[model samples]
Target: MIRMENVVKRYNELIALDHFSFAAKEGEIIGLLGPNGCGKTTAINCMLSLLTFDKGEIEIFGQQVHPNNNAVKSRIGIVPQELAIFDKLNVYENIDFYCGLYVTDRKKRKALVEEAIEFVDLGKYRKFVPKKLSGGLKRRLNIACGIAHKPALLFMDEPTVAVDAQSRNFILEGIRKMKAQGTTIIYTTHYLEEAEQLCDRMVIMDSGRNIASGTVHELQNTISTQERIEVGFITEDQTIEAQLEELPHVVKVTKRNGNYLIHFEKQENNLPDLIKFMESRGMSYTELSSERSTLSDIFLELTGKELRD
Candidate 1:
């Protein structure tokens, strides 16, 4: 549904996008992730033609993107990171106003607005104003406002940020429903778990460039750490850290609080080896859990920074 080729955007001396390129297939949810100041927003703005780039091309629906391309713009919905609803307008009114921008017919728009409310599960709060809603409810209102028009393409930036767990789950579930309805979504969030849970494919951006792009499993395989074992002992042993790091296939060992996180390179028997070593030393741990690599681990390994940073 969307494609960019060797796109470049600069701000004075700094490069916001350096030959950056990306693509999204129809009806797929794509997670765009990066550290702070990596130009994820800049790339989105350029794709929307809200910002002009110095080089490269951007196309949506096989047509070039431009500021005046209302035909193309009309098919895209954007739910910004910050709440973009009116505080005075009630939930229904806010949705009505935003949806009205695309749908002029009052009767048709009314149905759409109602559907959007139900889609986000905000029917009970229809008459409530933005200020009267909880953070999560307000987020739902924001999503309803953006998607009430039922565009084929959606851009959701941190839509679940700061919301309660239930609300976040509601928002994520709603996104899945949108995808099931065949909407192609471009999602950006600081939360790796959300991306892993919600996105079909993901693009990791860093230094204003697309460093990696693939499914969660494919991206995890790109990194050396194939497995991670987290163990908590009855007693925190300072000397054990170095010993664990020296174990076979153990790439690194880190201690946080009272738990030990052991990262292992691509190899089998990582857990059995660790358990054997522990039993040999007569060390009994209170907790021993093993899991494969996560998106966050791959992210940190590739970017050398936290998802939020």
Candidate 2:
């Protein structure tokens, strides 16, 4: 439903988007994962035709996107990271007002507003103002306002940030419902776990370029580390740590909080090898667990450990 080829956007000496290209299929959620200042927002703005790019093409629904293309713009919705609803407007009123932007007919707009309220499970609070609602409820209202028109393509930017777990789950479940009903979403978030849970495919970005793109399993296969073993000892010892580094298939060993985390490249017998090493040294562990690689590991491995501003 969307495509970008060699998209480039620059701000003076710094290039926010460097030959960045991305695409999303219909009825699937594509998680645009990246840290701050990695060009995710810039790419979205350019795709929406809200910002001009230096080169490349962006097409939505197989047609070039333009700011004046109301025919195309009207079919897209955006739920920004920051709340965008009016504080003074009641839930129903806010949704009605935004829906009015796309749906001019008063009767149709009224129906859409009510449906949106139910869709986000905010029907009981229809008359409540934004200021009176909790953070999560406010987030839901923001989503309701953006999606009241029921656009086919939706852009959700960190919709779960800073909310309680209950509210987060509610919003995530609501999003899944939207997808099941055939809405294609482009979701952006720094929360790797959320991306893992929600996205069917992912595009990892760093330094304004795509480092990797694939399904969770496919991306995991591309990285060197395939397995991780976490073991903790009763006491820390440098000699034992060195022995672990020499274990079969062990690529990296890190110690944190009195636990030894061993990273291994794709190979067999990784766990047994670690056990043998510990036995040879006559060392005992308080905890031992084996697990496969995670999206967070892949993200840090590709983007580096340095903190982003």
Candidate 3:
């Protein structure tokens, strides 16, 4: 639904995006994963035509993106990282005002506002002002304002940040529903677990460049960490650790909490092989669990950067 070709942007001497290119398909969520100052925001701004790029092309649904394009802008909704709401306006009025921008008909806008309120589960707070609502409710209100018009493409930047777990879960679940309804989403966040759960595909960007982009599995394969397994033994033994290291498919073993955690290069289901090898050695383990490299791990390894400012 969105595409960028050799897109470049600059601020003074610093290059925000150097030939940065990415695309999002229909009914899928694309996560722009990156650390702070990685130009994630810059890329989004350029794509939405909110900021003009120094060079390159951007298209939405085959049409060139433009700040003044009514068709493209009408189909896109952006919920920024920071909350933008009128403190004095009541919840219903806030949504009605934004929805009115796209849906000029009073009857149509009223229905859209109601649907948005229901989608965010803010029915009770419809009459309350932004300042009267809780922080979580205010975040939801911000989202409702952005998406009340039912845009085909939604840009959710850290929609769940700083909210309570319950509120976060609600937001995540709501995103899933939108995805199921075939709404394309460009989700950006530092929360790896949330991205892992909500995004169908993602890209890790740094210094205004896209380092990796693919499904979760495909992205993990790009890194050296193939399969990770941590086994806690009933008894600690350096000899056992050494033997475990020599086993087939075992690349490295480290001791921690009287246990041996093993890492291996990329392969197919290497954990079972490690377990079979351990059984052959007559070693008993109290606990054994396997995990793949997470988005955070891959993000850090690929970008060599942190998310914090």
* CA-lDDT, candidates in order: 0.90, 0.88, 0.86
**Residue 266 miss distance in model 1 (angstroms):** 2.2
Query: Which residue runs of candidate 1 sit more than 4 Å off their true CA positions?
Result: 231-248, 254-261, 276-287
List the lowest-lDDT window of 10 residues for candidate 3.
300-309
Count of backbone clashes for each model? 1, 0, 0
Residue-level lDDT tens digits of model 1 in 35-74: 6678888888888898999999999999998788888888
lDDT against true structure, model 3: 0.86
Clashes by residue pair, model 2: none
Q: Which digits, one per residue and each the tens of the lDDT, describe model 2 over residues 95-198?
A: 99889888999998888898999988998899999989999899999999889999999999889888889989998998999899899999988888899999
Weakest ten-residue segment in model 2 by summed lDDT: 300-309
Q: Per-candidate TM vs. native?
A: 0.88, 0.91, 0.92
- How does residue 169 of candidate 2 score in lDDT? 96
